[model samples]
Target: MIDHVYISVTNIDKSLTFYSSALKPLGWKVFGNYDSASGPEGVPDLYGIGDDMYGNGKAVGSSVWLRQRKVGETGLYLGIVCDTNELVDAAYAAAIKAGGTDEGKPADRTYFAHGYYAANVADFDGNRIEFVHKAWNPKRHV
Candidate 1:
């Protein structure tokens, strides 16, 4: 399993707001943040959130970190797992409400699998992300 993922963002504050609000339903929280001074020289400011332990006011590197991007830089695509179809819809609605563009509405993505329910959205800077719940044979939801 992946330990963490970091993505470039145009604005730290805006990205933090968007991510913290949008991913709340998935049990993610803003565990830590740091200005450039918190790192080695020339490091950009960062904001992090995820489903991991938060102690000593730092994220412990088990989260998604948003950092300042280079001029004219772009983004990353992430597909997150969900437990149910309703969560896919909730996350989509929350993302849209937080100013994310609708890449795709929540629905069964038969194009991928028999019961691949998912929703897609893009962050303010076009980082495409999807929340999915795949219902498989024997009705397993993962």
Candidate 2:
């Protein structure tokens, strides 16, 4: 299990808006913010965005941190799970409207498995992000 993941972006504000919009359709929202100066020991300052009260009514700390840095070529790709195919489509649209570059349009990825709906987009800083909806377990939808 991962507690959190952080990525560096050229513009924090732009990346924040991009991510916030992209993930909103999946029921995620920006919930916390952190300043590097105020962050604990080795952690960098970041904008914490995600559904905090996801499981057991306790924060799982599963969030994306947007940190300021110089823009450069990166191979980082972040994958987020969506509960429904509709959410995947909405996320792709939101990402594009939020200034993301469309890498792959929403479609069924039968190679991955049956009912695997997904879309990919590059964030403001060119980080590839994917939204996927797998119909493996219907009970997991939230």
lDDT of 1: 0.70
Q: Give the alpha carbon lDDT tens digit for every residue of 1-142 in model 2.
A: 2324567788888999999999898777887676656432533576878664443233333567787764464556576767778988998999999999988899987654477688889987767788877666343423
Model 1 agreement with the true structure over 40-139: per-residue lDDT tens digits:
4544576778774323223222368798888886777576766679978998999999999988899886644477688888897778788876564122
RMSD each, Å: 12.7, 11.9
In candidate 2, list every pair of residues with a backbone clash: 36-45
Quote the positional error of residue 12 for candidate 1 in Å. Answer: 32
In candidate 2, residue 44 scores what lDDT?
51
Worst 10 contiguous positions by lDDT, candidate 1: 53-62
lDDT values, one for every candidate: 0.70, 0.70
Give each model a TM-score: 0.46, 0.48
**Runs of candidate 1 exceeding 4 Å displacement:** 1-73, 137-142
